[model samples]
Structure formats: C-alpha cells, structure tokens
Target: MCVEKTPWELVIDFHGHTCPDIALGYRVAQLAQREMGIRPAPDSECLVKAYTQSCALDAVQVLNKATIGRRALIIEETQHHIYQFHFTGTQEIHQFTVSSDVLDHLKALQHPDLSPRERQNKVLEGVQYVLTLEESAFCQYDKIPGELRKL
Candidate 1:
C-alpha cells in the first residue's frame, strides 16, 4: 500500500516590523496544525520568539546605518522570506509576515502570459511556498528573480 503525502506550503514574511512576530508565529503554528497535522509542543513559542527577535534586530540595524550613511538600502529578498526583523536604540522589537500569497500575487501581476484566473492561481501557489519557508525557520536572502521571470 502506498501512502499519499500532502503537498506542503512555504512561508515568507515580507516588509515586517517586530511586534507582529508573536501573532504571526502563533498563526503559523495554527496553520501548520491544520495543513500539515504537525502539533508543535507548547514550548515551541519560546523558539519562535527567539528567532523573531533576532531577525528583527538585524534588519533594523542595517536599515538604520543605511539611513545615516546615505547608502543604498540593503535589500535582502530571497525566494524563502519576505518579512524581516530589526531593533533600534531603546526600542522593543516587532514581528510580522507578508504571507506567501502576497508575493505570488505580485508575481502573477508581473506575468503577462497567463489568463487572469491562471495568474491568480499561480499567486496562491507562490504564497503557499513561502509559508513552508517560514515554518522551517531557514531564510535565504538575496534570491534574485528567476531569469524567466525577468521582464
């Protein structure tokens, strides 16, 4: 007998601040349960929060320095993540996610070959891919757009 595994989705957080992390993290947990049937232990919150805080600080520091130095913003876009985290002097961190769906929607918007409905479907698929990325907690920055996607 062969068992059929469900296809998984990816997660990407886009243009995020720190405070949103908690909520998004919780949501991700819930989504995982519903979609993947993976029940993360109660202590999972601690791990999620830790990751959220760290990423937020890094993003913030980079943005701040770029602002003062008049350097080009250091944009880190990977296929895996859309949102990031950062901190400032005497400021608490925040968290957020862009949802993979959003990027897929953007990609569909950029593509001319598909019908409206097809493009919409593509967007949905892309968003799902991003969600998987988030759940794994591994982010890859600086992913260039695929060559075929270049306009």
Candidate 2:
C-alpha cells in the first residue's frame, strides 16, 4: 500500500533538505495555525514575518504558502528564531520562538573542528534529533501583543 506523507513531510521535500531549524519552524507554524484558528493559506491571504534568514524560512514558506513573491512572507535579518503570522482580514497574530536548547544545539553544529563531511553528518543527526522532539521540546509561543511590522 502507498503511504501518504504528512504535511510536514511534504514540507521537508519542498525544502530540499532537513535540519533542526526547519523542523522547529514546522512546529512553530503548526502552533501558530492552531492558535490563530486558521488554515494554511489557500492563496495569498496571510502574511508571515520571519526574523531570521535561515533554513527555517523555507519551511515557513512551504508549510504556510507564504512566499516573498506573493508579498506574504517577509525576511528580516536577526539573531533570533522568531516568527509572526498574521491572517489577512483579521487582527489575529501569532508569534513564536524556538526554545533556547534547540538553538544551542544548532549553534553547536557550527563547531569549527568538524570536517565538511562530519558537519554534514552532524547536521543530519541534528535534524533527526529535532524531528524526534515533542511539540513542547523545540519551541515556545508568546502572547501576541500587537501588530508586527515588516522589516
């Protein structure tokens, strides 16, 4: 029998590679969707403000269908794993940040001693480790205080 991939599995394929950041983004997006009581963008009906230009951005685009081309996804260069999603036609906004422990693991993957091949293997392992985490293990959602501006 043919097995169906979950939405996040499809996100992994669309992103062309797996990493801890992307996995964390996937979880964050899911949390935002659930909290905002919104579904994936059927068109260009939502906007995403991602505060980092990392692999996680690709997952956000894929999972939320919020692409820069559609003026629905905005990238801001920052040092944090923060993302805010706003559904068009409503004041609802959802904000999330990856847990510090997960971020520490991602930083550790950048250790200079590892060879290129070793780094590659370590990244794969990190991705697997992140994928195995329960929802609360990788991210924290913050109360949406106000509108998030694009930068």
Candidate 3:
C-alpha cells in the first residue's frame, strides 16, 4: 500500500532585532586575550559546534508549487540584526530556538545616573583592568573624571 499527503508550504518568520550586546562580549574577550594573554574565546570546539549545528537541516515541507516541485523546510533567525539561512531540511524535523535572557548586569550598567563620561570611563577601565597584569597609574589614584579631561 502507498500513502499520499496533501502538499503544503510552511514559513515561520521570527521578527525581532538582536542588539549589539553580543558584539560587546566578543570585544571584551578579544581585549582579554590580546592584552592580558588570556585564552581567546569562541574556541575551536565551540566554533565547530556552531558550524555543525547551523549546517544541519531542520525540516522539509512539501510545497504545492508546480514547477519547483518541493520546498525545503526553513527555520530562520536573526543574529546581530542580520538574517541568515538557519536550517534546511529534506525530511520533517524539529528546530531549536534560543531565547535571550534579559541580563540584569546590563540594566545596572545602563543606569542613567551614571553620566556619559562616567559610563565611558567605566567601560574603558573595565577593559583595561581585565587586560593588564599591572595596575595602571590612573587606577591607583582617584580617577580624573573624564569630564575634567575634556576641560
């Protein structure tokens, strides 16, 4: 006996914008490795894992189109606000979606009370401290408020 099913096309559009916080993480890791001699991130294993997962087909959808014949299932997602081919499937498959967690740390860092100068200084100091073995002279004494520097 043979079985036949109605042809259909399914498209899932996940609409959301990914901010640059992810890039900030990469910058931090790069700074640590370059200046402090810390191990660089996105290690080989993780990179390989990401490539493997991304290359894997997620699903297959039978399309009713006449000329094209059938449409491969697609699972689309946005990263850093760029859209890319997430998954392709030849057979029915399950796709995994990663939801972002609201990082409380970011909230604290983003507090408006910190003047723009202060915020920039914090980012700079944080990066500097993380990337150096010796305490910088600027860090030892009271930090000259970035405001004063402008004056």
Candidate 4:
C-alpha cells in the first residue's frame, strides 16, 4: 500500500537519514512556525539564519521552505545550534538557542570504538531522545529586535 508520509517523515526522507541533528532541526523548524503564528504575506518572506552547519539544516529547508539555493537560508560556521528566523516587513526576529543540556547529551553519544551496528543503534537512540524531548527543554526562546529584511 502506498501511504502518505507525515511531514516529519518527509523531513527524514529529504534528509536521507534519521539522526539527532535532523531531529534538532525538525524541532527548531516546527517551533519557529508555531512561534511565528502566521504565514508570510505576498511581499514578505521568512528568512532563516543558522549559526553552524549540520544535517539538521535539511529539516529547516524542508519544513520552513528556507532553502540555501534560494538564498533564504543563511548558514555560518559559528558551530552552535542557534537559529534566527526573520519575517520580512516585521520588526522582530525570533531566535532559538538549543540548550547546553541537550547539546551535551548529543555529544556524549559519539564514540569511535563502536561497531557499525552499534553505531547505528546509538544513532537511532539519539534520534528518539531528541524527538521525545520536552518542548520547553529543547531550546531557549528569545525575541530580539533586529532589521527584518535579509537584504
């Protein structure tokens, strides 16, 4: 039977695998959408600035429609899980900074000694950990004033 995949499933498919990074990105994208409340207007667009490069970004590109090719997704090498969403024509920017607790936990999962199968299992565990994390514990939410237009 051909079944329709859920949005999360589509993100996983677009990302090519399920991992903590993608899970983190998916959560950030979903939260950003909820926090923003409304969709963009005809003249306004939602732009994303990501501080660090990770597989998580694939989720943002999929769920937020902020693709790098379109110049709507900006990525930096700051190496942090911080994301800023700017709604053009608005006065505020929404920033989400992933917490240290979550970061540390994900880091602790990495090990070079495990077998391939073991590594795969750990990766799956990490994905589950991130997907089920409490929303409030996932990241710190902040509303900062900034220039909204990307240009």
User: Which candidate model has the greater TM-score, 2 or 3?
Assistant: 2
Per-residue CA lDDT of model 1 for 1-151, tens digit only, reads 9765322211123233222222233344343234323223432211111223323323333322222133222343443433322221212222334445533544444567889787666655544444445544432222222211001
TM agreement with the true structure for every prediction: 0.26, 0.79, 0.23, 0.93
lDDT of 1 at 100: 54
Q: Can you write out model 3's per-residue Cα lDDT over 1-151, one digit (the tens) per residue?
A: 9655322112111111112232222222232223323223433110000111121121111110111122222223334211111111111111122212222333345557888788776555543433342323211212111110000
**TM-score of model 3 vs. true structure:** 0.23
Runs off by more than 4 Å, candidate 1:
1-84, 90-111, 134-151
Pairs that clash in candidate 2:
none
In terms of TM-score, how similar is model 1 to the real structure? 0.26
**Model 1, poorest ten-residue lDDT window?**
142-151
State which candidate has the highest TM-score. 4
Q: Backbone clashes per model, in order?
A: 32, 0, 0, 0
Q: Candidate 4 has what TM-score?
A: 0.93
Q: Alpha carbon lDDT of residue 13, candidate 1?
A: 30
Question: Best-fitting candidate, measured by lDDT?
Answer: 4
